[model samples]
Target chain A: MLNFLSTALVPLLASLIVLAGLRRRLDLFACFAEGARQGMGSILSLVPTLVALMVGVEMLSASGLLELLGRALAPAARLLGLPEALMPLVILRPISGNGSLSVLGDLIAKNGADSLVATAGAVILTSTETTLYTAGVYFGSVGARDTGPTIPAALLSDLIAVLVGGGLVKLMLFS
Target chain B: MLNKIWAGMILISTLAGLALGRGAELSGAVFTGCSRALSLAVTLLGVAAFWSGLMHIAEQSGLLAAFAGLLRPLIRLLFPGLGRGGGAEQAIAASMTANIFGLSGAATPLGLRAMAELAKGQPRGMASPHMQMLVLINSASLQIVPATVVALRQEAGSAAPFAIMPAVWLTSAATLVAGVLLLRLLTALARPRRQRASEKGGLRRC
Candidate 1:
């Protein structure tokens, strides 16, 4: 762990810090501030869906829909050779990464940090999150809501990422 | 209007969902389960509706215009070709906000609107620098909340899901840098030829 921190985390941190500094240029900062403000404003537009989405997930879990889904997905995970517990992670990941992470963390704890679940978590970490919703916020801010070209691309990218993460980790480490 | 319709449908569906959940002839425990799922969906849609409406009011009031003014200069400097349409500035702001709050679902509408704005200003046969920049930035966004990650970790019963805060901060920086660097490369390659042909024509006329 110490070696990983030294070799990976530190260097990554250094470069990222440098990039952050560069992004703070007057022009970039302006863009960032503007972007943030618009994002917030647009968020105001979808408050209901936002709230519903969150609560809906919670309700689903409470309703045992997730448990049902979990069981249904178990066979698929087994075929994929993924840890069944991580199915929650896969399902909720698209709706909300934060939600998914909580489940992933639990699985990791139960299955052990060194298990396939843990490694898969790392891979998923490096990929995109909440893509469709995000694409909407940015587009909506401009007052145009059509996601014709972008949605397909973003979803495709996300799907590829999931399989890639799960597959790579399985072949290299789990195998 | 569409939202209202969607809301009604969702509401009815959820209620029906409640019945379906509770209606198990065989499994008595099913009622307990369906009630919880429908209940959650109701709560989430309700809040999202409020926030989304707030944005509409802001839009009608022209707040986006005012906000766009401040970022215009900066946007122009970086995205000189936005030419009035890139609407990149607004889109960037909106996308950032979505990422920050983890409102990915709501973010898309605005992002598309903003991109259309950018496309509107672009000249024929030339891509809008602002639009491209938006794409790059969105691709490598530096998230503030990473709500999904947090939620996932928490759901999984992590002892310290928030521990990824440092990792997120670090990665955003790295990704931002990578994105900007890529944009810089693209810009260098597509810097509009510096008005050379027009300048040469003027010089000859002189």
Candidate 2:
């Protein structure tokens, strides 16, 4: 039942929007074209950042630094009852969305799709925003020099979310 | 900050490769990384574009505004100082609505406009409490449908792409509540200090 709902969600949403547009007498095709163009532009702008981050993350993993770092942080992760593999994702998540997504892909590849690590990673990714990027853009837009506890508060919240998400995934999915 | 992190990763990776005698492997990783990024982006493009287009239709048909209207009471509670039906209020509502619906392409612009509106008549270069709350809420965005993550999970061949939805919703709500409480606490703590500082300044002037 849940699987069917998930599969139906996108088509349902699309149909609903289209029907609404028709009812409003909108030029749906033209609107879609314009928005799709904007989406393409946004994706293009993301390419460079993705390339840079992916290279860095790949090199980190390929050179075995990630493993070393993971081992170094293993005690802390153990204390939190988290897998060592999730260290990179936890750190990269708040910094870069694409970077964290790359880490998440690697996590799912290393651990099976149904593994606790992958589920936890997915939950964390879905729940948390890219804190640094969001802060930069939101504050930068208004020329606000003093962010005044926004970043710290947000990061604290993200940490709570990540920890809670890992636990939730374990309890909900695995159990 | 991002610059530092990105450069540090490259430099550390190079040094590690040299130390580990994996220069050839490191070079290979560069190509693989770029290709991986491109592939991932290609996978994402279709979903992102389709969703963006669909959201555009929704926006044009006034569906988004209707959703925003539904969020007005919540907005009023979250952003207390905004005048009812004012620009900031409306922008905040729209942005929050877009965010919940996972239309980040629209959310960012609306969020920026809301920030600009909230910043009006505020102290120069200082973020008002309302502005801070706005950014905080955005950073802890409570997305009802995590479309991007679901799409990525699907691309990764997950048997159940939306299996994590319940967890996502739980975590998002928790984080948003925690963030709001923390922001309120910080703002409350800062207010007295600012007032005391101003009092000291007045004394110095006398």
Candidate 3:
């Protein structure tokens, strides 16, 4: 059920419905081609920015800095009612989506799938956005030089999401 | 902001990698990171192409306008300076709709289009409030389905991956609210004191 919803069903259904509804009046194939071409161009241009940010995140994680940082922030994690196991995940969550995913996978593997820590990690993974990546790619694509308020706003929101995600999991599942 | 963060990441990684005697690993990560990002862009290419193509059909069929109409009230509240019926509004609404359905890959191309639309006629390096808020909102996306999380849980052999629905819903909402509020507050605080500066003629008015 979950597989169907995520991978294929919803998107296919939505596309089919939209196509069916719009068939009579427009040249659908032409529109698709134009849009797809533009899409490709956008993604192509974003590759450099994405690569720069990803390398930053990847090296940060591989250099043991993440571990040191996580250890330092572990006490704050406890203060927020989050398990110590979640410290690295929360810290890495906003910086790198794929990095956090691997960490979440490791967490679930270590602590059973149904464990409170795993559940909270899963929720945090789902709820929080990758702040640095989004800022880099999206703003880079637009050629925006001054990211005046976006980064700080996104970081604060991520902080809130992490805390809220942990708190909710604790209240709902552990109680 | 982005330049600083990128430089900081490089600086920290280099210092830490050398100190920890993992210099080789750090160098390898640079190459691997490039490949990983390339593959990610390739994956997003497919997702973005399909959705953008579909959205083009919707736009040609006038469905895009109808969709933007539905979101106008909220869009207006968030971006009061944006003109109605403009490309930015259509792009933003399409992106938000795609995001709501939990397709970040698809949402991104639409967001890029929206940003481009918003960037038109603006100064080369300056980002308008609308652009700033849009970036923040997109960065802190609120998805209704969160299909990725469910799929991850299912793969991990959880009995019910969808069981985290409540947590997903609550947490996303909180982040969206917090992000928007912070954007509003910070932008207000960060604005230049143009009145005082203008009186002294210290800065030229654009």
Q: Give the winner by lDDT.
A: 2
Which scores greater on DockQ, model 2 or model 3?
2
Question: Clashing residue pairs in candidate 2, if any?
Answer: none
Instruction: Give the residue spans of candidate 1 off by over 4 A.
Output: A1-64, A75-81, A109-112, A171-175, B1-206
- DockQ, per model, reads 0.08, 0.67, 0.44
Tens-place lDDT digits, model 2, residues B46-121: 8778777888888889998898899998888888867999999988998898889888777899899999999888
Give the top-scoring candidate (TM-score): 2
**Candidate 3 residue lDDT tens string, B1-206:** 55676798899999999999999999988887787667656656676566656656765676645655697789889998788877888889988877765555568788889989998888766678888888888877577666555655666688876677777778888998899999998877876664466567864435
Worst 10 residues of 1 chain A by lDDT: A143-152
Candidate 2 lDDT, A75-108, residue by residue in tens: 9899988888898899988888888988887787
DockQ of candidate 3? 0.44
CAPRI-style docking class of model 2 based on DockQ: medium
Q: Which ten residues in a row have the lowest lDDT in candidate 2 chain B?
A: B197-206
Residue B19, model 3: lDDT of: 95
Of the candidates numbered 2 and 3, which has the greater TM-score value? 2
Which of the predicted structures, 2 or 3, would earn the higher lDDT when compared with the native? 2
For residues A114-143, write the lDDT of model 1, one tens digit per residue.
Answer: 566765764555455555445455554554
- After superposition on all CA atoms, how large is the RMSD of candidate 3? 6.0
lDDT of the structure predicted as candidate 3: 0.76
